[model samples]
Target: MNIKKYILSFFLLISLSLFSQEVAEKRDAPKPEIKISYLDSIKKTFVRDDLASCVDSLWLKELTDLDLYNNLSQDIQTINFDEQVDYELPTEVLKARLQEMDEKSPFHIEYNPGLENIIKSFLKNRKRAFERLMAISEYYFPLFEEALDKQNVPLEIKYLAVVESALNPKAVSRVGATGLWQFMYQTGKQYGLKIDSYVDERSDPLKASEAAAQYMKNMYAIFGDWDLVLASYNSGPGNVAKAIRRSGGQQNYWNIRKNLPKETQGYVPAFLATMYIYEYHKEHGIKPERAPIKHFATDTVMIKKQISFKQISDLIDIPIAQLQILNPSFKLNIVPSYKDQAHYLRLPQDKMAVFTSNESKIYAYVDREANLREKPFQIVRPIVPQDSINTLQRLAQAKVRYYRVKRGDNLTTIAQKYDVAIEDLKKWNNIKGNKVAYGKNLRINGTDVEQKLSAVAKVEVDKKAVIKDSLGSKMDSFYVVQKGDNLSAIAKKFNISVADLQEWNKLTNNNIQLGASLQIAKNSIKEDVVAAPERKDIQYVVQKGDNLGNIAKKFGVSLDDLKQWNNLTTNSIALGSTLIVAKNEIAIVTNKAPVASFKKKEEYSAPATEYYVKKGDSLYSISKKYPGVTISDLKKWNNIKDEELKPGMKLKING
Candidate 1:
């Protein structure tokens, strides 16, 4: 009798354990409230909108009270459909199901499941979500397939994003894993997704997909098991490894799943269900509302120049949403340079012509607005290892290919010292014949290697140059220190090495103390002064949604320069007040060439040109004006942005 009683107790405990898990899942869900009136409203709208119509049939009776009760009993800890059993479920039954789904499914979870709505009125709410998912599938599937294939990853893993973000690019988890793939900043950074003051490339569909593929591939290589690979993705590899250790070295994910984190345990199930939903959506009465994917035939446009999203939007008729969708890497709505200082601009097949024709015009817009800031573009030279003494020596001996324009250095003297073509230097730096900045660094040898080598040599020279220059201008110097100035960012703006900045300021502490004025000598005035109330050494309040870029931009400065000026470690800026900015002065570029008209075509005069102006133009138009101009001749002569042209525009003849 004792043994039997013990056995019974053990079974009872097992039952209770199962019951608890079920109860936990169900506690958050309630019976959806159904209204017959709401159902009728949906029916009317569906017919009006010419969407799928709902016809009430005897099929409503198919799910009897006994069936619901039985289902409820099986999952007793779940919603109590058994207790609510009745002959005819009032319309509330439908409402209850919708409500239960809204809460129980991903729709109401912290992870975004698209726009939220209480769709219990009819099957339409769930139907709409399914349809939207299908439409998005067209765009995402191809990209996911390509990335996953390249990484030799399982195609099924692409469905993981559906579970994580439901295809929402802006989805943010409770724990702050953001973007379509829902990667936390640290994790995304680990996988090489750049998050910066200007952009978070992890949110980009193409980039994030590639990152996800690579991450999954790495996880697979680590565990050699797909299930474990998934577990690692959910809870991280460390957690999975821990679970395996706890499970006495079980290699299989399922064997160690019980030992895994609770959230991770649910993760696999959720992923599987999502996959099923994605693949067999039609079986679940879901139809895709296809939002046609806008096709773009784009090429890489190297923007050694800085540009803004607003500028692009204004230039092209493409909506901001479309551009943002195309390039999710831009964090502050500004695209930074890719490794080559280039960015891929995805333009639609038709709009490419318009973009190409107006390329320079768009750039001019950015240039004028961009330079309005008091801070200039900080040229951040990649660091060289000091241990490479031989490399540094060679670089030093390579005849310093860059000349830092001094108060006395002229183009002729600079050209003679470097033994370079003055025209080449001017052309390389986009100088319009004779104009140059006093403190600008100009390239002597336009070769890439020479430029790289010269920058290294200048590291030592730049430091000395800054100190000597500072000391030489001592009579013109004044030190005014404000809040939040850092050495590195400041040095970049001034075109001085950080070491030189420290040496010149005698900053023994290596910290720029607030309210302390550091010395600035003559020739320190790289920019003109703009009048504003002095900072008064007061704390600045950060305003709402104020990021580093916005704050810097608001003060007419560059982000890196701001960090340097303020001595910041991170670019985090919160809303509601102040930051130390150059209120007393503004950097102004007075020597850049006024906007010129090398690319814009103001006139077109040929039968073929009509098509260029109105609808279409081939390369033949150039020959009509200049004669003996082949299609290649025209391509070479006009510097036409793209191969295509709209009707109207003077076709210059190529020689």
Candidate 2:
């Protein structure tokens, strides 16, 4: 009997322990809190236009600065929807879910139809954006949380970055607000974010997050409410205060919602919706994509001297794009050389070890390269006496005119057209080579002669002179063709014609070789007797949406010329069809003999199709496989933020 009673007691104890565990589990499980009081109030004050406009403005700002992914919307569309289960939760169910989640947060995560719509919009329409956001969050959220936690601010405040910048650190708003936190220039400066030619700390994730945390803390202190603080963040505290006053001293956000700016009214709802979706996204079947870099994967080191991204990339086998993303504050891809001051460089933690190990070697390489490029070729103007101020002023009474380099423009051609020396053009624009990029503005100091001639006339005269002078001994010169060279460009550079170049080189075609030596001759023209080309009609294809005025403006011809050429009665032209454009009334040409020969094609190799990463694959090494692809391109295409690739990684080699 005693043995049986002891066995019974043991079984009873086991049963009681199991019962207690079941009760604890039930208590811990999240349940819907069906409270409609807050929902009712939000409905009464809901303004659809205000909310939509606010969200639109935020997205517009986000689109303006988003650079990480191209065609983000299209990329999102490409995400497979098979994993997503389509089942709409009732408004009450979502409200309950949010309420259950809200029990753990300081901010009121109330659910209303407006908030519900936003949540659905994100979950359904913007699933891919949300997925990307989630991936990016893995990298940035920790930094934000740490900063906010240190300040004792609500951790949920980190979601503000999503609304502010969509997690892009380099985002700049239409209003000039910049970075993940979207601080205005003045505000960024006020918060100790240095903005110079080399750095805009507003874009630095860690520093900007810290600044945002402090700013939020200050806002919270003033309003004593997180929702109000959010409103203030969106449209300033002064506006929030005025809204409260306009609402007859109501400090509640909903009470003053009508009086707040249209953007602020939506801001609070968007934040609330964002918080809810982020927490409950998994339930909706959204999974975060893999982030390019994980949090804690990167480490920062102080740079004592200035170094460029290319230098770090070439020497340490890091990708320059990775460096740029890691150190976005360094504008111009340059880490400014600081004396007695140190700048911080962030790299992947693994690369940090390599960087430290080869610190001396890296610095030596950078210094050596710098010394080689230290003194660039520059034209030195003759020193004038201080008393010759008037003469200098007349010569320099320069009208600062901006000329955008066209497809066929070189420093030589540009200088000849502007009646300035090539060296002077280079000096004025800080250009190092004969190459001028298309669409880049070149500053032209118009002399007295250039001012008197029409642009078309000047170009024609320069073209004629360059062609006529190709073989003339009076102005003979030698030119070594650089990359991106063509006969037109060479002729422009030497103030000669393409026909003359082909004639002198005894070539039937226009193909020219890099590094080939060419001869140039000056135009021997009686400058006063040069006549401009007569106005003549030229055929032009009317592009889609081309109006007569636009076509006229595009060709630098008058609308009258277009009308006269095409015999059009109206300012309209059919698409994909031709229209005649009469040339300007006159184009000046200098009568001169040709003197230059175009060179034969040298041995040139095409870009490689495939490149395998070797044991020491670096930006410099990889760059050699493809002509024209820079270290920046390697970094950008590979999404390499800090370090170089390991051996055997495939890289796309595109010129």
lDDT of 1 at 300: 42
Badly placed stretches (over 4 Å) of model 2 are 1-87, 374-655
The residue-level lDDT of candidate 1 at 62 comes to: 22
For model 1, give the 10-residue run with minimal summed lDDT: 586-595
Give one digit per residue, the lDDT tens place, for model 1 in 186-237: 8899888877566677777888999999998888889888778888888899
Report every candidate's CA lDDT. 0.54, 0.66
lDDT assessment of candidate 1: 0.54
lDDT of 2 at 95: 80
Deviation of model 1 at 430, angstroms: 31
The alpha-carbon deviation from the true structure for residue 446 of candidate 2, after best TM-score superposition, in angstroms, is: 32
